[model samples]
Target: MIGFIELIRASGFAADVRQVKLVRHKGDDLDMDQLRNEGWFETYQCFQSKPVFDGCTHIVSVIGEDATASRFVGIYEVQGSTTASPALLPEHCPYTQWGTESRVFYTLKKCPGFEDLEDRVVIDWGKGALAWHQWLTDRTIMEIRPRGRVLAPFRDFLRVHLSFEDLGNLATQPTAHKDWVAALSAVGGIYLIVDSMTGAQYVGSATGSGGIWQRWCDYAKTGHGGNLRLHELCREDIARARHFRFSILETFSRSLARDEAIRIESFFKQKLGTRVFGLNAN
Candidate 1:
């Protein structure tokens, strides 16, 4: 069988190939529930260190507790890399909470997968189906397909609740994802950016001409939406600003007066105690 590494190289990528990883993160509970429900495809995956995965092109994710070749998730096509404090790790990848140092970060695009053909066997590590695996040689191959049930189908649709990690894609990808743009654009309203790093919240109003979508687009582009307080926050740490979760606290008609929205914003700030003890400067 053509091994997984060889298959990728034959597909025309020239970057250094790393061994396919069977990421069975023990004790990490954050992303597991979502992965179990959604079939585990996303734009970002993180590592505790870069040196181990440096100069790599891709990581083939597998799901399991032990290194047994039970199942393969899918391939993550590497784009670019950057590092941030463990605090900046997305809610989906909270496994980094165990790390005492900075974590490796990358933007990974999902490649096609044969979920139907993956994980048909459960080979012992370094023998049989998993024999190709070797420490320090991640490009190692594994069984073409284990014989058994493997995956739940990917949802292939947008969900209503927006996640911080998904917001990054909204900034870069087109609006065809549907729910984010449509729901956010449908009304002008009061929204909140909750800082996951420290639980600081910023109350803001989007009662202007373009509504919440336009306002959020400003935030996605500039990481601050031109708010002086948020501008300062971004200046101090852009990653923190990018990790803020955008949620609508309440919605109002697009025709609502802008002044009324500002009042509502202030009301929310006072009601929520954001300005006195949070990120809001005004």
Candidate 2:
């Protein structure tokens, strides 16, 4: 089996394996979702509790779970470090209590030449995931996915479940997965949006011309989907939408009337107590 360090060396990013540390970032599903989807994982990693990467000249970063192969994120050149500030944390950061921990913020520069492998390359880091930070000599190359972890093909609508980040990804890259768009577009549906932060739910339905896809795209873009209560919440802090998770309550054929869709949505709202106990206003 070819080593991960060999591939990195061949790519011409780092000439010496001794100077590099292989780091795998794995956390709870919520943290992992934000890490992968929120676009701040690299910056977030800078706030370590200690100067763990102090002596390393460079670092190879991957994200995955313990006992599982990880996906390549990037290679970063270690520039230097400083004490972390409470204000430096992202607003929606999962690690809100980092202030309690004595953290060192390391300055890292993205190494060039390996941009093509981001999210496409996978590696095996042995079974010691608890030893997340390791010397480059200890890692192994597992697989290289040319498609770069494309979203799985659309399955059943009843089985449809998506995080807020998931919806944003699908909306932002509509052309990336035609089958998913096609599947969502094929039906008008009653859907549920749950604020994972507060357990509040918003029940809604889509019978628009473009079906569920169009309606959800609006929510992905605006975070409120034109609802009064959600608008109020997002107005206070837009990042709060990151706490939302979406799923289908029921699906309707395109032939369903708008009134019938609304009726179905009301049925779910009443059943789920969204109006009285959740985020729904009506």
Highest TM-score, which number?
A: 2
Q: What is the lDDT of candidate 1?
A: 0.58
Please give, for residues 201-232, the per-residue lDDT of candidate 2 as tens digits.
Answer: 99998886799999999999999989999999
Q: lDDT of each model, Cα atoms only?
A: 0.58, 0.80
Worst 10 residues of 1 by lDDT: 150-159
1-282 per-residue lDDT for model 1 (tens digits):
555545545655344443444343322445442443333334235544554445556655555434443355555666666664656555665344533356666667767544444444222344433332233233344444323333222221232334455565555653334445565677888888887667888889886667777888888778888888778878888676645777778888878987888898899999999889987888
TM-scores for all candidates: the values are 0.50, 0.68
Deviation in Å, model 2, residue 73 alpha carbon:
1.7
